[model samples]
Target chain A: MPSPAGTPDADPVRASAGAPAADRAGGPAGEPLIEVRDLTRVYRRPRTSLTRPGEAVHALKGVSLTVHRGERFGIVGESGSGKSTLLRLLCALDRPTSGSVTFAGREVAGLPERSLRFLRRSLQIVFQDPMSSLDPRMRVRDLVAEPLVALGEPVGDRVAELLDAVGLPASAAERYPHQFSGGQRQRIAIARALAPRPEVLVADEPVSALDVSVRGQILNLLADLADELGLTLVFVSHDLAVVRHLCETVAVVHDGLIVETGPVDDVWEAPGHPYTRALLAAVPTLEGML
Target chain B: MLTVDGLGVRAGDLELVREVSFGIGPGERVGLIGESGSGKSLTALALMGLLPDGVTASGTARLGGRDLVGVPERRLKDLRGRTVSMVFQEPMTALNPLMRVGAQVAEVMTLHGVAAGRARERAAELLGRVRLPDPERIARSYPHQLSGGQRQRVMLAIALANEPDLLICDEPTTALDVTVQKQMLELIAEVAPALLFITHDLAVVASLCERVLVMYGGRVVESGPLREVFKHPRHRYTEGLLAASRLPPRGTRLATIPGSVPAAGRFPGGCVFRDRCAHATETCETAPELTAPELTAPDLTGPEPRGDGHAFACWHPRR
Candidate 1:
C-alpha cells in the first residue's frame, strides 16, 4: 500500500508483490527506491579446537521489504535482531549470504568496485556514536570535505554551505570534533553524510548517544532536512516513540525477521503481532504519564 | 529515612552542584531528573560519600539521625553498605569479571562482617529474591556469561544484599533494552525500601518514582509529587523538557529548549536557566528562591487532597 496520511509523496505500488516491479511501474510513481528480497546473512565463527567444528549465527533470516522513494521507513528491533545486518546489506557495504538488494532498480549485490562507487555516493550512513565514527584529530572542515574530495568533486564553498545547513556556525569548520559537544559532533557527522548529496540516508540510532535536550535538536534537523530535500530515509532504532514520530511506515524486527510492517499509526494504535504489541507496551510515553 | 539540606559539591574553584535539598521518606521513591552535566549523578555520589578526589561537598545530609556529608571516611565506610548503598549504570563494569556471580553477592555480605558460612547461603537467596530463575546456576556463572538483564539482576542482588536503609541507583537501566529495562525497573521498585533513582529518561522516572526533582545547571529547578509535577509543571525548564520528550504526530516539529545545558560553574550568576527560558524577565537577573506557591492548607476532606507540596525555583513560572 502507499504510505498513508503524512507521507503523501510515497509512490504507489502493489503492497505485497513478491517480484521486482521496477519495469512494471517504470516512473518514480510506482518504482521503489530500495528493495530487499529474502535477504540473509550468516556469520561463522572459526573452530578454536580441532574437536569442535564451528559455530554459525543466522543474523538475518531472509528478511524482505521495500522502501519507496521519499518515504521515511523505519526498522525497529532490540539488540541483535539483525537490523544492523540488514542495513549493511541494503547499503551494499556488506554482501548478503543469499538474496537480492536492489537500489534504484539496479542490483546491489556483487556489484563491481567501480559501479559500487555510485552506490556509495547515492546512499550515505550516519552511525550511532559520533566520537568513534569521526576522526579526533581532523578539523571539521576536512571531515565534511572528505566525501566530496574522495569523489573528485570541487570543494568550493560547499563546506560552508553544509555547515550552515546543519545549523552549525561557519567558524565551527576550523575546530576539531573533540572541541564540540556530543550534539554538535553529531551535527558535523550529519553534515559530512550530506556532503555527497545522497538521495537516501540511513541512520542507525542517530540520537541514542545524545542527551535528552539535544535529542530533539538532532531529530528535528533530520526531519527538516528529509522534508526539504525530499530525501528517502531509513531510520533504524529500538525506540518505538522515536520511530513513530519520524517514520511513515515501520517494520518491527524480531528474531532476525520482520514480524510486522504497516503504517506507523496503525501498528502503534493496533498492533497485530505479539512482539510489536510487547514493544509498544514497553515504551513509556508522556501520554502514559498523564 | 534520609534528609538533605543545602547540599553543594565543588571542585577547587568550580561548583558542580548547588543548593540541592530533598528527602526520601521511608518506603518512598524519589527521582532526580536532568540531562548530562546536570549534576544528578554527582548529587547521588555525594549522598553516598563516594565523590572522587578534589571534589568537596558542603551541606548537611543526614540518614536516620547520622550525618552523611562531612563525616570521616572511616565512619562513612561503616555506614555505607549497611545504611546506604548504590547501584551504578554500567552493570558489566560494576561487576567483577573474575568472580562468579554468587561470590560477588556474598562478598558484600562478608565484607559487612556476616558469617562466612551464612554469606554464601544468603547470596543465593538474594539472587532468587531478584527473580532470577535457577539462582544456583546463575551464581556459578561469571559476569560475562550472563546476559545484560541477568547481570543487572546480579547488581541488584549485590546492592540489596545488606538491606541498606537507602538505595541509590544512578541510571541503572540506561544500558538495558526496553523490555529488559521495564523488568529491571519493576524489580528495583519491588525490592528497594527507599529508592533515590537518578536518570535522564523522564518516562522511566514517571513510571518508577512517586516524587520528582528536576535539575538543571547544577541546581534543583522543581520538586513535587510525580503526578503533580508531571501534570502541571511550574518551571519553564520542566515544561520544555516534558514537551521535548513527547512524540508529536508526523511532520510536527518537536518543542526544543532554546540552548543546551550550560557547563558546570559556567551558568549565569543569577538564574542558571534564564539563558534558555523564554519566560525570563528583568526579575530573573537575580536568582529566584525555590518556593511552593501552590501549597496552602490541605483539603483533608477532599477525595484527592491538595496542598502546597510543589516547589519550583523560577521567578516567572508557568501559570
Candidate 2:
C-alpha cells in the first residue's frame, strides 16, 4: 500500500477529480449486463432472528432493472429505501428471499457458492468510507493486491501501477491505511476495486463522505474509469446532484420500491414522481458562474 | 438581537477564529457558510459557551443586552436551554440514545424549575411546533428509534424547550439526504428563530439566511445580506466557495479552489486564503485585514450581485 498524500484525506479532486462533458462522452453505451426481476432482500435486525418475529426490514421490494453493459446507471433513495440491500444482493454477498438476478444472463440469484466466486470479480462494489472498507493494518499495495491475490493472479508490479492509475504516487502503496487523507484513501479503495478489472462496479455513496471540493474530483474519476475500462457502473446515492451529473439513467427508489426510473435529463427537467420532484427541490443548486 | 465583536478563539497557541464579527436582528436568519476546519461551527460553540476546556475565547458575544463573553459557567448554564439554545449538527450524538425523546426535551424546562407534568406537556408542544407527526407517540420513542428527521425535530424540541431568544443551528441539515434536508431546512426556516445558522450547503444558506458571513481558515472573509454575498462575493475565498458550491446556476463543470483548506497548525502569516487563492500576489505576504468595502464586485453572472447591502474583505478580490 502507498502513503496517503496531498489533502486532509481522500483528495478526490486530484484523482482526475470530476468529469467535464467531454469526459462523460469518452465511453459509448452497450447491452444489458445485469437484469433483475422482482429482486427482494429481507434482513432481520442485527442480532434478531426470523423464528421470533423480529422487526423484519424489507430492504428491497420488487426491484427490477436492466443495466446495460458499459453503462452508468444510478440508483437513488433515502437511507432505508433498500439501495444498500440491492447492492449486497447484486454482489452475491447476500441471498434474496424471492427474485431473479441474471448477470450476463447467467441466472446468478441462486448460483451456488462455488459458481458465485467466479462471478465475484465481474461485479465489484466501492463503498462509502475507505477507512472502514480498507483494513487498517495492511499496506496500500497489499490492500489493492488482495483482490488479485484472492483471484490467484500474479500481482508482481501491478500494485504500484494501480496506485499511479488512481492518481496516487507509487510510493503510497507502502504506508498503512491511516497515513492517507480521506480522498487518498478512497482512491486506494478504487484501485483495489479495479485490481481484477471487474465488468461492473456498484459504487455506493463513494463520494458522499468527501467534502464538495474533493467530491467533484472523485465523481470525475469514476466517469474516466468507466470509460477507460468499458465497465457497467451502478452508482448509488441519496444526493440527486451526484446522480444527475454522473449517470445517464436513474432509478429513484422510495420506501423499498423504485418510484421513478428514467434517463437523467427527462427526470431532472420533468420529474413525474412527487418523491423525485421533492428530491430535486431539496438539493441546493449552484449559481451560474465559475 | 445577537452581536459578536472581535470574537477570537484559541486552542493552545493556534488561533482558530480571528476578529470575527456579525449580527442578527430579531427573527432574522443569518448563515455562516464555510467548509470543514473553517471555524464556523467553533464560532457557534463559542457563542453558546460550549467550547471545550483548554480552548480560550476572547471577544464579546452579546445576546439581547447581556454580555456572553466572560459570563461565568454557572450563569451560562442557567442561560442555556432558557435564554439561548442550540440545535447541533448530529442529532444522534446530541441526543442520548437510551433516553426517551420526552425526557431529553423535558430536561430543559425542568432545569428551569418548570414542574414535571408541565414540562412533559411542553415537550410535546415543542415537538408539535417542529411539525413532528404524532407528538405524543414521538415523545415516548427513544432517540435511536426515531428517523433522522424525527431525531432532528427532537433536538429542535429540546432547543426550543425553554424558548430561547437565540437558536444557533450548526450544519443542521448536513446529515440528512436531499429530500429530508429540504424538509428540515424548511421546518427550521418557518419556525424563524433569531438564528446564527452555520453550513457548507451554500444553496441552503442562500435559501434560508437573510445575512451571510463567509469564513475561510477561521477568519471572516465576507459578511452581508444573502443576495449581496451570493451575487457578488468580493473575497477570493468567498468566490471559490460560492463557485465550488453545488447550488443553482453553478458552472457546468465542477469549479475547484486549486488547493484545500490550510490546516490550523500551520497558520499562514499572511492572508489565510493566499496559499490556495488564484489571486495571491506579493501583497499577500503581509496579512490583509478584514478590510472595508471599496471595490464593488460586479456579479460575475450579471445583475444580481448588488442590491446595496453586500460587503467583502480582500486586497485582490475577483470579479
Candidate 3:
C-alpha cells in the first residue's frame, strides 16, 4: 500500500497558489453543484437483548435538495434532526443506505477513497468546535498547511497567505491552538479549511461555539471570504436567524426530513408548515421585544 | 430579595471576578449577561458559596439580609435550597444518575427538614407545576431516561421544590432546542420569583429579564432596564453586543466587536475593555467608574432604586 500522504501527481487538478478570485463567481441559477435524489441514511443501534437484533434508525428519510454553483445554501435543524447525517453524506464521509448524492453530475455516495480525489479537492468542511477540530499539538502553521501536506503539495508561503486571509497575524503561525482565544482559534480553523482552496466550503455550526461579541466577527469573516473567493457555501446551523444572515436559500430539516425549503426571507416572513411556524415562533427574536 | 455589593472572586492571586455589584428585587427578574470567561458564572458560583477549590470570594452577598460571603459552609448550605437556590446549565450532570427524578427533588426538601413522606408528595406536585407531562411517570423516571428539555424541567422542579426566595439560573435553557427552550423559558417565568437569570444569549435575556447587567472581563460594564439599555447602550461592549446580536441584511457585514474577549486574569489593568474598544483614549488607562450616565435634563432626580438605574463604565460612551 502507498504511504498515508498520497502522491501529488495522482490528483491532476491541484489548486494553484494565488488562484484568481471570482473565477467561479456570477454563475447563473439552475446550474446544480450538488444534487440529491431521495437520499436516505439508516443506522442500527447496539443490541440490548440476545434474541432481537439492533433496532434500525432511519437518520435521513428520503431527503432531496439542490445546491446551485456559487450559491449560499443553509440547512437548519435541531439536534437529532439528521442535519449532521446529511452533511456527512454530502461530503462523502459516509455512504447512504439508499438513494444517491451527486456532485456536479458525478455520483459520490459510494465512491471509494481513491476515487474521491475530485470531491476531496472541491469540498472542505469547518466544524463547530474550534478546540476539538484543530490539533492542539501542532503549531498554527502546520495545522493550516496540513491539508496541503496530506495532498502531497509543496509547502510554500501558503500558510502565511491563509493566515492573513483569515485575519490572523503572521506571528500566529508559531503559536499552538491553545494560545489563541475561541474566536482566533476559529479563524485558525477557517484558515486551515481555506488552505485547500476548495470550491465548496461546508461549515457546520461555525459560530455556535463562539461568544456573542465574537460571533459577528466570525460570521462576517465567513461572509466576506465566501464572497471574495466566490465559493459555494453550505452552512448548517440550528438557528434560523443566523442562517438567514448568511444564506440566501434555506432548508429546514426536522425528524430526518426536509420540512421547509424556500428563500430565507419568505420562510421567515410566512412559514407554511406547522413545524416551520413553530420554529420561527420559538426563535425568541429581539424584534419588537427589545 | 438579593443584594450583591462589590463581589469579587479570586483564584489564589488571580482575580477572576472584580467588584461586581447588582441587586434583584422581590419577585423581579434580572439577567446577568456575558460571554465565557467574563466571570458571569463565577459571580453566580460565588453568590451560591460554591466556588471551586482554592477559589475564595470577597465582599458581601446578602440573601434575605444574611451575608453569604465568608459564611460557614454549614450556614451557607442551610441558606441554600431554602432561601436561595440555583439551577445550573446542564441538567444531566447536575442531577444524580442513580436517583429517580422525583426522589432527587424530594431530597432537597428532606435535607431541609421536611418529612420524607411529605417531601415525596410535594416532589410530585412540584413536577406537575413545572408542566412536565405525566408528572407521576416522570417522577419515577431517572435523569437519563428524560430528554434534554424534560431533564431541564426536572432540574427546575428540584430548584423550586423549597420555594426559595431567590432563584439563580445559570444558562438554564441554553442546552435545550429552540422550541424546548421557549417552553422552558415560559416555565421558568411562570415559576421562578426574584430570578437572577444568567445567559450569553441576548435574545433569551430580552425575552425574560426586566433588568440587564452586562459583564465583561469580570466586571459589570453596563446595567439598566432591559429596553432602555438595549435601545441606547452606553457601554461600547454593550453596544457592540446588541449590534452583533441583530441579523443584518444578507451580503452585508455585521457590525462586529473588533477583537475577541481576553482570557480571565489577563485583562489590561485599569479599563478591562480598553484593549477591544474603539473609543479608548489615554485616559482609559485609568479605570472608569460604574456610575449612572449623565442626563441632559437638569431636573432629573437622584439615582433610581437599587435595581433600576442605567449605569455603565466607559470613558467615551455612545451619545
Candidate 4:
C-alpha cells in the first residue's frame, strides 16, 4: 500500500539504489553507521543477607556486531536473553562494563549527556508498548513535536506531515492518546520517533503488543518509512518470522551471547545453532500443516 | 460434550457478545479465534458460569446435557472443576502466590470430592504427567520461585487434577516463550480429552485444532474444518485474517485490514466486520445469516464430525 500522503519529497536521504542491492546480495557494502565491539554489561542483584555482597549477573558478554547505514538489522531472542541489554548499549542508553561502541568512527561508550546531542539526533527508539511510551497527558500534535522541540528545531508543519506519512488524519492531532485505538496509538508513536528525522530507527518488540491484524499495518508502515527515508533500522523481536519479514541480516542471541548471525534467509533455511533450530521449529506456522 | 447456542453476554443495556453458537464432541479439539474485544474469552467464561459481576449470560449452553446459563452458583461451583475446567492466559496470576504449587493442585482435587490423602498423591502424578522436571521438588516450591513455564505447567496440573470432560484454554501460551509454549501445547493435547482453545494466533490454532470458529464483535462469523477454513476462507474477515497472518516477502508490504477492532459494545448493528471490510455493500448493513455455502470442491469434514457444514456469515464472499 502506498503511504497515505503523496511521495515524501521533502527528505533528500532516499536509499541509494546500490545499498539495497548490496544488502540483498548477503552483506551491506555501505559505511558502518554503528560499530560495537566485545560489549559486556553486568548487573548486581539485590542482597538478601546482611553484610553480604549482592550476586553479579552478566547480562551481556563480549557481544559485537556492526550496523551498516541504510541496512535493516534484526536481533531475535526470547525474554531475558540479553537482547535488551545489547539494544541499550547500542543506543548508548546504558553503559557497558567493557568494550566500546563507536558511531561513525567516534566513541560513545561513556560520553556525558550534554556531549551526545549529535547521537541523540541521529537515533530514535520506538518501545514495545505505545500506551506506556507515549505520554498520556499530551495531545497528539505536541507529542509528535516533542522530539523536534527538545532538539531546538522549528516545529513547522512537520507534525501534519508525519501524521500523513503514518496514515493518520490531521484531526487526530487534537485528541489525547487514550482516544486512539491501539494501532493508531502505535502510529502516533512512530510519527513521534520520525519527527526529528533520525538516521537510525530502533524498534524493540514494536508490534508485540498490537493485535494480529494491526501488526501487518505497523510492519508495512515501518518498512515503507525506512525505505523512503533511507534510515538504518535496528529491529529487535522474539519472533523470527516478523524479523525475517522486515530485515535482511539476523542475529540470534541466547543467554547473553550471539549464537548465530548471518543473512536472515540463510539462517531461516538452515540454522547452525541448536538453539536457533529449536526456536525455528517451535514457531507454530500454517504452512502445509493446515 | 459441549454445545452453545445463541450465547450472548451483556452488561446493563449493552451486549458485548451476540449469537455465538458452536459445539465440541467427546475427544474433539476446537479453536475459537478472535482479536481483542471479540468476546472469545467471555464465551468461555460463560460456559463455566464464571462471568464477572455486573455481566450476565443469555441463551442455552449445554455442557453434558446441563444448561450452564442461569445455573445456581452452588451447583455451578460443584460442576466447574469436575465437569469443565479452564486455564487462563497468565499462569502467575491464575495460581496462588501464598500457596505451594503442589497444594494448589491438590486443592482442586479435594474440592471436587477426592480424598485429601489420595488427592495429594495424584497431584504429584499430575505434575509428572505434564512433564515438569523433578515433580516432587517442584511441588514444594511457591509460585514466585518457579519460572513462567513451570508455573504454567503447575496450572495445567491443577486443571487436569479432577480429569474434567472438557478443557477451556484462553490464550494459555500467549505469555510464554516459543519453546516452552510448544511443550505446553503438546502436554495439553496429550492430556485434554476435549478442548475449546481460545487464542488470537491463527497459526497456533492451526497446529493443534481440527475445527475452527472465527469470532468477530462477539459473534462466530465462520466455522468449519481447520484445513477448509484456512485454505478456502469465505468470510471477508477470515480471509483478511489469514492473509495478515502469513509473512510477506522481505521488503514487501503485508496485506492489512483497513481498520482496528471496535471497542466492546461499539460494533455496528448488522455486520460486525463490515466497517473494516473492503467489499461491504448496502446489503451488508443488514445482518447476514450463517449458512453453509455450496462448494465446487469436495467437503473435507473433520474426523469427529459435529454435522455442521462449512458455514460463513457474509453478504458478499470470496469465491
Candidate RMSDs in Å, in order, are 5.6, 8.4, 8.5, 7.6
Worst 10 residues of 4 chain B by lDDT: B299-308
Quote the true-contact fraction of every model: 0.66, 0.38, 0.85, 0.85
Runs in model 3 lying further than 4 Å from the true structure: A1-30, B292-305
Candidate order, lDDT descending: 4, 3, 1, 2
Model 4's DockQ score: 0.41
First chain TM-score, candidate 4:
0.90
> Model 4: what TM-score?
0.93
The candidate scoring highest on lDDT is 4
DockQ (Cα-based) for each candidate = 0.41, 0.25, 0.39, 0.41
Candidate 2, B95-134: lDDT as tens digits: 9888899988998899999999999998889899988878
Name the runs in model 4 displaced over 4 angstroms: A1-25, B293-307
- Greater DockQ among 1 and 2 belongs to 1
Give model 3's DockQ, 2 decimals: 0.39
What tens digits encode model 1's per-residue C-alpha lDDT throughout B1-319? 5888899999999999999888788898999999998999999999999999999999999999999999899999888888899999999999999999999999999888999889999999999999988999999999998888888899989999999999999999888878778888889999998999999999999999988999998899998888889999999999999989887888888888877876777788778898888888889989988884354236423221221278899888888
Q: Model 1 lDDT vs. the true structure?
A: 0.85
Tell me the lDDT of model 3 at B276. Answer: 86
- List TM-scores of chain B, every candidate: 0.95, 0.92, 0.96, 0.96
